[model samples]
Target: MPAAAHDLRTPLTVVLGQAELLERRLARDPSAPVDPAGTSASRARRDGCETS
Candidate 1:
């Protein structure tokens, strides 16, 4: 299972980075539209969608 976990590390890091990036952007531009707001509720719903 370590290999599987290791394989996921890169993608999980990307997820966290993207979340951080979204947070930074949202902080800079509060009024900007970011899909469903990236709130906990919205994030839970958006977790499944593939990003570019």
Candidate 2:
């Protein structure tokens, strides 16, 4: 099911990219309150809500 795989790929990529960016930002500014896991986008993802 290439179509199903592709559908999953985009969102997974988005989540992974966001995580990497957050990781870099935290590395540079450890005191920042921008927690990736606490973000609205991440919350919706964890709750199985549509991000779009």
Tens digit per residue, CA lDDT, model 2, 1-52: 9888779878876886686577666668867776546854456567765534
Write down the lDDT that model 1 would get. 0.62
- lDDT over C-alpha atoms for residue 19 of model 1: 70
Q: What are the TM-scores, per candidate, against the unseen true structure? A: 0.53, 0.56
For candidate 1, write residues 1-52 as lDDT tens digits. 9788677766766776677677777779968776655554346337843333
Which pairs clash in model 1? none
- Cα lDDT computed for each candidate against the true fold: 0.62, 0.67
Cα error of candidate 2 at position 43, Å: 17
Q: Candidate 1 regions off by >4 Å? A: 33-52
Clashing residue pairs in candidate 2 are none
TM-score for predicted model 1 compared with the true structure: 0.53
Number of the predicted model whose TM-score against the real structure is largest: 2
Give the distance in Å from residue 23's predicted Cα in candidate 2 to where it truly belongs. 0.2
